[model samples]
Target: MELRRITYENVDAVTSMSVRDEQQNFVAPNVASLAEAYVCVDNGYAVKAFALYEGDEPVGFVMLGLGYMGWSAPPCAEGSYCIVRFMIDQRYQGRGLGKKGMEACLEYLREKPLGSADKVWLSYEPENTAARELYHKLGFIENGEMCGEETAAVRDL
Candidate 1:
């Protein structure tokens, strides 16, 4: 699995990708996530949005925001980068792409030159067992924090 920048050429493909109906409440769609990335950028947070590709086919989306520099959104922990949005398309689920995609995102974030931070954070609905299990397998631990109704988890980078 590889991550490619979301560009005009692939924006539609990325935005059209959808998670399963059961996961709708747990994740924002790629279009909304891309919009959030723009809002975060306009608010001064460094941001990155990517299309997850398996070989040459787009299969998922990920958006990352660095720091709490946004004017309206709550800030991340000091200088941490947050995985603001992520989801693999329903068509691409159950093939281990989510794990590989997350690994790719984590690897990219680790080398990112935003503010220095020891951890990366993300939040998910508490009832989203799939997400909780996937994230746990990826080494993310719940920090007993809440982002609105979502449970927050962090991983040392």
Candidate 2:
């Protein structure tokens, strides 16, 4: 599979992603109003945003944002930082696609020019332990901060 940018033409593929009722609970304003994916990809402010495509099919996606510089070095490295949003179509789950999407995010980070601000952060609903755990195993640590429907975590690069 390859991770590529999502276009207005790909909303169908993106909305086609699998999401559980509980997971859906975390996403709101419906797919149309959720600019989480659209905004990041269109704005250069984000690191990179892409869709995971298997052949000609898009099975999942993520939006990786480079964190800003400041007193946030320990959370990141020092110059550039990052975060991501990911999802797979419900019918596409259990095939380890989450790992694939995350691996791309990590690889994207690894390939960046080294700096103190080089790291990635992510947030998930406090009740979403599965996502929290996957992020943990991938090297994220809880930042002890929670907002709205989610809590935050960070991984130093």
Each prediction's TM-score against the native?
A: 0.93, 0.73
Each model's total of backbone clashes: 0, 13
lDDT (CA) per prediction: 0.84, 0.64
lDDT per residue (tens digit) for residues 10-91 in model 2: 9777766657877886544226423654564465444455677767878877655555422133333224455545777777
Q: Model 2 residue 26 lDDT?
A: 52
- Which candidate leads the pack in TM-score? 1
Clashing pairs in 1: none
Q: Give the Cα error of residue 24 in candidate 1, in Å.
A: 1.0
